[model samples]
Target: MTSLQHVSTISAPLPAPSRQPFALALSILLTAGLTGYLFNAQDSHASLVLLLGAALGITLYHASFGFTTAWRTFITTGRGKAIRAQMLMLAVAVCLFFPALSAGELFGQPVNGFVRPLSVSVLFGAFIFGIGMQIGNGCASGNLYHAGGGQLRAIPSMIGFAAGALWATRDYEWWTTQPSLAPVGLIDMMGVVPAIILNLLVFAAIAGLTRHLEKRRHGELERDDNGSDQPWSRRLLSGPWPFIWGAVALAVLNFATLALIGRPWAVALGYPLWGAKAAEAMNLGLDVDFWGYWLMPGRDTALMGGILEDSASLMNIGVILGALMAATLAGRFSLSWKMPVLQWLAAIIGGLMLGYGATIAFGCNIGAYFGGIASGSLHGWLWLVAAFAGSFVGTWLRPLFGFSRT
Candidate 1:
């Protein structure tokens, strides 16, 4: 890639507004009611965590912290700042998670990390998910926030994602049948302190490497980001937030989720559960409980509950609504009826593939990559490598679908 191609770009900036009072009022009132109801109906703990998820959505939108765009920029532009920021976030998360996980308990509750075996399913699933991210124009979390923010096309992508995830459930038995290596937890093997040290070392090395590559290619580290001279409060409410700030906040939020939920955060697990509920509602009579994939106690129970009762579902809703609120505040929340035929096609296909891939892989970016890595799973490292490779292929296919590359 040339120096010209390495520069970052935002094709469409969010529209400006002095205020979106209606959205501001609506967003707060609706969520407050839901949170109050959930506190009475469910646990106060889960309700609070759901609100945190909304905060995450707001942070994500304001910052425009995107894995898809970041990866695409790196692939096409040789920019490594985003990747470095990811490393920093991961490093902080590692510090926070290790001591908690290594103790094998938090707040008097026993907890464990996701440490799944290395399998063919993970490799292929993450790879396909990578392609889906490019085509769908977002990852699991990305799709949620963008959809909430009234990106009309995100709805189709989300539908496709759920469809694809359910479709992959049919092959759950077959996918796992591929010979696999046993799961390994770095903490379990090397102890908490060693795991933290090793992870930090790896993160530092990667950060250093990206810095070298980017500087060698582009002759500088920081990208041009001229900001508006708006008041602090106004700018805070309406934003194109700093990428590093978003990254740090996400790491902290994920840590909080772990503390509250007793496990690492997961974004895509609810997709299939939502599908099963929909199928049941439609009188399709899907025997999800009998399905071998959800034979476990946790999976089985999540299936039995209504969507609103599920914690992950609540969090997901919060994220979408939060993004909606943020976009509204930014005056960027508007529907678009017109989309290119190929773009629509890409969205559907990409979403479906993402859903399918995430199912097989054990999680999406949040579940497998972020939480998995923070929890010291070997599968997380492999997911990163495989998904990046898939992104390379997906980037090549983008122009064929009429997405312009910078």
Candidate 2:
């Protein structure tokens, strides 16, 4: 997500430009190579998931879809265009997810929602994650797409995310013991139709509130209606797509993920595993031997397996490659390695918070908030409130790290 200082206001459309042929070629090669490797080594499903991830990356990049930026802009500027877009995305997702989830299967494959317990762990973790994302300048999904889009700054943030996730593993069991309510799904409490209706009402209320605030503060709503003047074919391939398009694409892609993987799309779950893999390669301590998370049956196998074998990891790679391809196609794949000391420090600290918070909270914005709410999990609502509060504080703290509030 672009920082407040970097936020684009309404402007005349730019002409379409040529693609970065070398970068585009490289991205395509990497994506195709990984897809083929996953297909041959794992199965057709793995390859499909990877492609889905790439598509998500492309959508996110083209649309500039972002959580951190959306929240920050709302807090600092009262512009809720992106926030409204998020509400739209979630609304669409629930409309698609609720019925399929209630049925217990899709196309003969068992499927489940991301319903998780509501707990103090979630409150604290999500709160810190909010702060971290503000300083780190990217949420989990933001980190992947930004890194893939050739933002070199995200590299340190991602590195810190991995380390923080690994560090959280040392105390995962204790956090789980924090006071909590059992997992509660709105669909379980009410029927699917009722749950959907209730969720839609809440989404409408939020969107309406944003509009009211923007009207009061700015005297007019900021429109997300800007894009290139190119033909449809060119715009589809190289884009600054309208916000609604991004929202719909994300919602549909998430639905596709559920049908393929039996679970909603997620990103943070793969970070610790990646960290552990690096640690193992460097002769660091084996987390599987000590960390309770890695000791679990499913996680243990994932830890022991090939890097590309894990769906989450593979999907993460796809997101990066996809973003690369998107940026290259749009002729905007520049990478810069310049940064001040304090900003760099902020990135590291923020990333640590993002990883640690997501680990304890049971998910980042994508998994816990987006997936959870769409699945009718009460925890998602809790995550949204807590993370938003944390983001408020984070927005204020940005100035300390050389970031402007507005």
Top candidate, metric lDDT: 2
* Per-residue lDDT of candidate 2, residues 21-47 (tens digit): 888888999999988987887789999
- Model 1, 101-159: lDDT tens digits are 99988878777788888989999999999988887777888888877776666777888
TM-score of each: 0.93, 0.96
Return the clash pairs for model 1, or none.
Answer: 6-77, 62-241
Off by over 4 Å in 2: 2-19
> Candidate 2, TM-score vs. the true structure?
0.96
Task: Give the range of the ten consecutive residues with the poorest summed lDDT in model 1.
Answer: 1-10
The lDDT of model 1 is: 0.80
